[model samples]
Target: MSFYSGIDLHSNNHVVVVIDEEDNKVVDKRIDNNLHTTLEVLAP
Candidate 1:
């Protein structure tokens, strides 16, 4: 399986989108604007 990730950075927060090769979204949501939290959320 393959995955594609996109990050929409805004002034207040960030939107994350994780998709597959067929453009099927695996995960989509918004998170707090912070480096540590972002990494933690993305960590596997």
Candidate 2:
């Protein structure tokens, strides 16, 4: 299986989305503009 991710960055917060090869959404969230938070969201 393959996965892809996209991030919509903003000034204070950002939107994160993860999808599979079939374009099925795996994870979708809005998180603060912090390194740890971003990493946690992106982690499988």
Candidate 3:
């Protein structure tokens, strides 16, 4: 019941993805580079 996340950061935006323990993708998104936006997407 655990999850893992990875992000590919760029100057203007970021590509983020999250996967479960079984390696199934749970979340996939492209978000602004802004810190608040990133945090919101990552929030539980």
lDDT scores in order: 0.87, 0.92, 0.92
Cα lDDT tens digits for candidate 1, 1-44? 88889999999899988889999988787998999988876775
Q: Write the per-residue lDDT of candidate 3 for residues 1-44, one digit (tens) a residue.
A: 99999999988999999999999988899998898988888897
Better model by TM-score: candidate 2 vs candidate 3: 2
Model 2 C-alpha lDDT per residue in residues 1-44, reported as the tens digit of each score = 99999999999999999999999999999999999989987877
Candidate 3 residues lying further than 4 Å off, grouped into runs, are none
Q: Record all residue pairs in model 3 with backbone atoms less than 3 Å apart, i.e. clashing.
A: none
Worst 10 residues of 1 by lDDT: 35-44
| lDDT value, residue 12 of candidate 2 | 97
Candidate 1: which stretches are off by over 4 Å? Answer: none
What are the clash counts of all predictions, listed in order? Answer: 0, 0, 0
Total clashes for model 2: 0
- lDDT for model 2 comes to 0.92
The TM-score between candidate 2 and the true structure equals 0.92
Q: After superposition, how far is residue 16 of candidate 1 from its true place, in Å?
A: 0.4
Residue ranges of candidate 2 with Cα displaced over 4 Å: none
